[model samples]
Target: MQRIVLERAGGTPVTKRAHLGAVASGNLEVLCEPPAGDGATIVVSTSVDGYEPVWRATLERFLEQHFIAAAIEINDFGATPAMVSLRLEQALELAR
Candidate 1:
């Protein structure tokens, strides 16, 4: 397992918590909650190794578009980049 942590500045704070997706069979789950501060923090735990760059790029693009201030947790199980983005968007939507 590999763990990646990314932090960003500025965004609309998440008022409610959300959980989406599932961690099984090439899928993943996203958990979003109100952050302790004004920025956004994301913690990703993936079954795949040496994919930090991919994870960063995927998440950066999402953050650039949404820019939500929330504590996000991603538990990945060999999920594709597209699936990751989808789950994140879903989690954010549910959070809002």
Candidate 2:
């Protein structure tokens, strides 16, 4: 599994670690922590890169549709924007 840390340093430190992983044929597995408490904090791994806008947009949309509280970490392994987004949501969902 890989680790992607979305950390905002020197300010309102809000770290989101998205543990991402590969899934069966065109699928993904994601787990997230939104910088809070925890209980068997899940970890996900993925492979989605070079698509910052897509990630950002996807996060926004996912956040809009869900609510999270704790740190989130991501681990990617060559995934597409859509896949990344879906993985992110899945992670968040798992968190919830």
Q: Best candidate, lDDT-wise?
A: 1
lDDT of 1 by residue, 1-96 (tens): 999999998899988999978899899988899999889999999999999999999999999999689999999999999999889888888887
The per-candidate count of clashes, in order, stands at 0, 36
Tens-digit lDDT string for candidate 2 (1-96): 334334222212224455566555566556555555432222334454455655566655654554444455545555666876776666555544
Q: Candidate 2, which segments miss by more than 4 Å at Cα?
A: 1-20, 23-29, 37-49
lDDT agreement with native, every candidate: 0.92, 0.50
lDDT, model 1, position 74: 95
Worst 10 residues of 1 by lDDT: 87-96
TM-score of 2: 0.49
Predicted structure 2: lDDT? 0.50
Q: Given candidate 2, what's the lDDT at residue 6?
A: 44
